[model samples]
Target: MSTGGKVQWINPHMMRAQNFTIRFVKPSRHMPGIVALREIRKYQKSTVTLIQKFPFQRLVKEIAQNLKEEFRFQSSAVDAL
Candidate 1:
């Protein structure tokens, strides 16, 4: 979920499908498309845990390089603010 609010478990089973029921919850916000697709391919794995274990090395390097290059080119003291 988005972590912006809470979900209520009012009606557990909404309707039945081929072999499953369309259960329901609250907060009324739809999940992102990428999240849904990743879940489908995870083989019943927990996306939350996977995201928690994700490495930030690439992201950190990109950010550090950007800062270094910016200062090397045309940086001012105001950039630190």
Candidate 2:
């Protein structure tokens, strides 16, 4: 043990100072359409319309609605795509 508690001791101040990690993960194949859906949600008539109009619209619509209502969002169907 070289002093810094453990292999994964997260110091909030240090982590903030270091800035967010720059992840290189590739966007899903439907990313562009997903973005488009975000721009269109304000005008969607129904969940069905959202699903029919965008790539992953069902998930995106649910997430957006949850975010609007709860101020937080997370995906449950992680393996669906």
Best by TM-score: 1
lDDT of each residue in 32-53, candidate 1, tens digit only: 7976887687856653543321
Model 1: weakest 10-residue lDDT segment is 72-81
Clashing pairs in 1: none
lDDT computed for candidate 2: 0.53
In model 2, pairs of residues that clash are none
RMSD of candidate 2 to the true fold?
Answer: 20.0
Any runs in candidate 1 off by more than 4 Å, and if so which?
A: 1-55, 69-81
TM-score of 2: 0.18
Model 2 regions more than 4 Å off = 1-55, 69-81
